[model samples]
Target chain A: DAGITQSPRYKITETGRQVTLMCHQTWSHSYMFWYRQDLGHGLRLIYYSAAADITDKGEVPDGYVVSRSKTENFPLTLESATRSQTSVYFCASRGTGRGTPTQYFGPGTRLLVL
Target chain B: AQTVTQSQPEMSVQEAETVTLSCTYDTSESDYYLFWYKQPPSRQMILVIRQEAYKQQNATENRFSVNFQKAAKSFSLKISDSQLGDAAMYFCAGAQGGSEKLVFGKGTKLTVNP
Candidate 1:
């Protein structure tokens, strides 16, 4: 309960359907990130939020939307999901500090699109 | 833009042996951070080790250590006394000192042979 958690550990949805993956962190870290892990592509950042209401696009932001209404919550939404979007989604949080700030990751949500 | 590269697609090591996973990166920033993350079958991304660019000493955690060559832009992970639990996908990542985004490499799948 003291770590980050992602909802819908496993999801299967049809293409073109809208889906939202939730991420909640109890640490209240200032930085939160969403990443998609695919074979041959370790992990690509989809979106990140520095703080409440402050979000930025990451490497692969297409077809994805993210919002951070609170410091502990950052949700990623697939407005129109595609088969290509099916992958393991990971949410990570990091505190603002020095000497290579460590990131805490949650058990990823595996999404499959048909 | 920074890019991380993991050339080895797969590797294997006998139990209790040692294995090294290679990683290379391209970045113009002088100050940054490097990390190695392991993902097991459970799909949980866990931090293995971290190295700061400005630090001359490599970082180690338990039996996992890094051979960091700043001039060569190489950060390789060496796992000693490998165990069955060490079998997983290991990813190398780089992040700028003050930036929130992390650039990740294509992971290397490690297999521990009996």
Candidate 2:
């Protein structure tokens, strides 16, 4: 495919278990982001990567860890999943930095922690 | 910190009619970017339109358009000739000039009625 793709569209895990959401983009964008969507919060950025081996925390990165070992993949991991982390996670990519490029998003991953 | 606000929690428009979703943001940065994203039941986040703060003219893509008011710090989305496919949750986002993380608003659920 030529677009961004997310794995495990639907996931259900225990509260203390670890879960990882994978995001892969074929465009080889330099910027990749992870966002969590909830009912009243809309979407909140969890983490973002500027390029390979360069990542930063976003608005809601408390329980999530993100790593970008390559330009095409940005994976988000929840070390100890909590019920509060149950939400839909979205991955987006852009060809360049902010203010000069458009972001393309992938199909979200719906995670449920019980 | 930058913040995006979408006051309308929900809205409905008849098919073939026009609908506008209001969005306001708070930021001290002069140069930035604004965006409108659509998420349907499928959970795919799709970019609808984008506007740069420095640009005077509004940005439009097919049936989607934005009314950007820099002075008022408002960026509203106007969907013309609304169709059944337009029913979804629309989010307003803002990105700093040099930052890749996006600050999103509490989305507006837009319904296109037949």
Top model by lDDT, which number? 1
Off by over 4 Å in 2: none
lDDT of 1 by residue, A5-99 (tens): 99999999999999999999999799999999888778889999989999999889999999998999999999999999999999999997665
lDDT of 1 by residue, B1-114 (tens): 899999999999999999999999889999899999998989898999999998999999999999999999999999999999999999999988888888889899999999
- For model 2 the TM-score comes to 0.95
DockQ values per model: 0.77, 0.77
Per-residue lDDT value at B17 in model 2: 100
Steric clash pairs (candidate 2):
none
Which residue pairs show collisions in model 1?
none
Error of 1 at A18 (Å): 1.2
What are the RMSDs of all candidates, in order? 1.1, 1.3
lDDT string for model 2 (A17-71, tens) is 9999999999978999998888898888898898999999888899888899999
**DockQ (model 2, Cα):** 0.77
TM-score of chain A of each: 0.96, 0.95
Candidate 2, residues B36-71, lDDT tens digits: the string is: 989888878888988989899999999999999899
